[model samples]
Target: MNAPARIADFVINSNADDLAQQITLLAGQINAATHRLLKLIAEFDTCKGWSGGGTVRTCAHWLNWQCGIALGAAREKVRVAHRLEELPLIDAAFEKGEISYSKVRAMTRVATAENEDYLLMIARHGTASHMEKLVGKFDRVQRQRTDRQHDKEQENARKLVYYQNDDGMWVIHAKLPPEAGEQVIKALEAVVAPIQEERQRELQESCSTDAHGDVSAETFSATVEHEKRESGNHFQELLEHTRADALVKITEHFLATSAGGTSLQALKGAERCQIMLHVDIDTLQRNGSTHAPNPHCREFEHQQWLSPDTARRLSCDASLVTLCRYHHRLLHQGSFSIEAVRDEGHDSPALRFISAAGATIETSFFPQFPGVSAETSPLALQRLAPDVDATTSCPYWTGEHMDYGMAVDGLLRRTQ
Candidate 1:
């Protein structure tokens, strides 16, 4: 049918379902046409049709100017066009109108000949949003793995060296990871920036003429002092001298505070930043194998999984909070009961765990030294473990011993 006749008929007779079907059919046709257009663009790019003796920088630039496509979208089209030439399966799917341009665009970003079939399968089954999310996650995983490897290399290469040169001047050189280097730079700038600004203001003020159209006596004196200071190799020497003085001040402050001479509140730039890690107890204690699912370590901030060794290194100077997987599983499986307790003598509420056999476990907190809770008496301890006498004193064993090893082995031995 002719274009006008089909439109007139559609306007007169179309129902909702018919309109939906026609829209779907037209979308398919548009996709097929777009596939052909991309094919032409690829061929044109190969022939350097838009190069025009280097007048145009790229085919995407030409498209943006002549075809009125947005520059970013034009670049994406060009990239997808070139990529499709290499992936025959995706190219055929695009030509057959089985997938839209959006899916092709996303797949081409992370696709290779080895993975093209898998990507095509996903494009066939998943929506554009799914494809976008999959691509994003894949990029993040790849980037994180790369970053971890790079960080390890940087850490191994870190060092600080100092020596006295032949001129009796102390020289220092340091190599640090990005985060540490940034902290050092910030500390130096924090100390030096104000001094630099003050110097700049003095220079501006001393050079300015007074309101009476002549330099004031104070200004002239200040200018003469400034000139005397700037007599030879002025700007660079002054800057280096100021930085050296700031460095000395910073070192003195650090030594004073570290030696307990005076306790100054931490400066904003000197505050420590903590990295949160989620790791299983077994992995943390034993440096267990990462291949095991139960002992895996993950970084909370970046959502990246880390190796056991890295987790241990991070935990060296860190405050630890542990959750045992085995105990958690047992708790979930109805092996124990936990409840909040707030007695008349207690200052704060605490969690109490009771075994299935009605034996109360230790309380979460012990404010004062009632070594063992009244609920868990020596008789109850003997009832739980008949082999060991509850009255026997062990140096490492105490009612208030909250260490993980003691809790897991000594205190919870009866439960196991």
Candidate 2:
């Protein structure tokens, strides 16, 4: 009988456990022999020893035509064969049948002379999946290091440039730091999420609703298919429109809020967004001194510069008010509030802006009082003082008679 027939007869007669053990042993032997064969093919290809000599463009192509192997398998074999030359430990492990080809394949992608020993140890003890995961982590770490190095080299090149085009439209090109760029992207995506969700809900409801109540199965199937296609096309258009709308919302949100509060406040540390503007002490006291030049202040929110008069107008209405950050969040959830402080005599009150907890002082005032005209509402003074008698005329009171009694009556009614 032939050797194969003899082996088949033995395998057919053997017990289950023995057959299983023998099969595993034979598989390892086949794997080891395959590596040896690949190494020999690599050596022959290196010397141009094929039938066509050096005429073949690649060893993989030569193997595919001559050995009847698939192109993908031949290419893989040729790659591993070359890698084996540089990886002595892995090559030895393969020959000894201590590791599988799957493990060795993953190692070769990231293995270098410096890391070969560590990689070989992992291949010897770990499963093929474990080896793949290790290789992936190694690749990610290497890529992150490379990215940081590239960013450092390009640090000085970061800038924002603008120019007016021929059509009279302004074009802005910005090169921001990686972290800042990521934050901008995240903010835009956050804004787009709800918009996409709302559109999807509307589409789902519209697609499922049928005016004709009852329908045949065939008709129902056709309607569903048509609706699916229609919804898909509408979804694409919705995505495009949502992105544009989100950008506009982000711009408006940033401009309407001051330094202490921004729409993007959730994405950044409160301290990072806190802007401090230095003014002359005399100007702050209204002594007619010119405001100091604040070089630290830069244009924000569409790059619009704040004029001196505008800055002065904003400062005059600024006030210190205390509220918890959670309360601030609730207010923003319901409606936005302008930060304001209660002006007290020259003793800068014990209020320092706190951003640690959600509690902080806002420097702008809310314009929600009655009797304040829309034109002068923003400029009206607010008093939270306890000693101020109700009989005194309130600066905020704007009624026909400007009398103390009228002011007292309005204050009591508003409080009640």
Query: RMSD to native for every prediction?
Result: 32.6, 37.3
Candidate 1 error regions (>4 Å): 1-14, 148-192, 195-416
Off by over 4 Å in 2: 1-14, 50-55, 148-416
Q: Write the per-residue lDDT of candidate 1 for residues 222-276, one digit (tens) a residue.
A: 7757776767577778878888888877877775466445566443342345466
In model 2, the clashing pairs are 319-340, 319-341, 320-341, 325-358, 325-359, 339-364, 340-364
lDDT agreement with native, every candidate? 0.66, 0.59
Residues 1-416, candidate 2, lDDT per residue (tens digit)? 99999998887778665766655555455456666777898797688665241224478877775565688888888888889999898787677555677877888887776667766765555567666776666555555668776677457667888898878776767887778788877988999999867865554555554674545556656765676687998756777778778987886666555434545543233333444343433244442324443343222223434445655665664543344565556455542333334556543423344333334534322223336544422112111122222222112222333233432333234323
Point out the worst 10-residue segment of candidate 1 by lDDT. 389-398
| Position 49, candidate 2: lDDT | 62
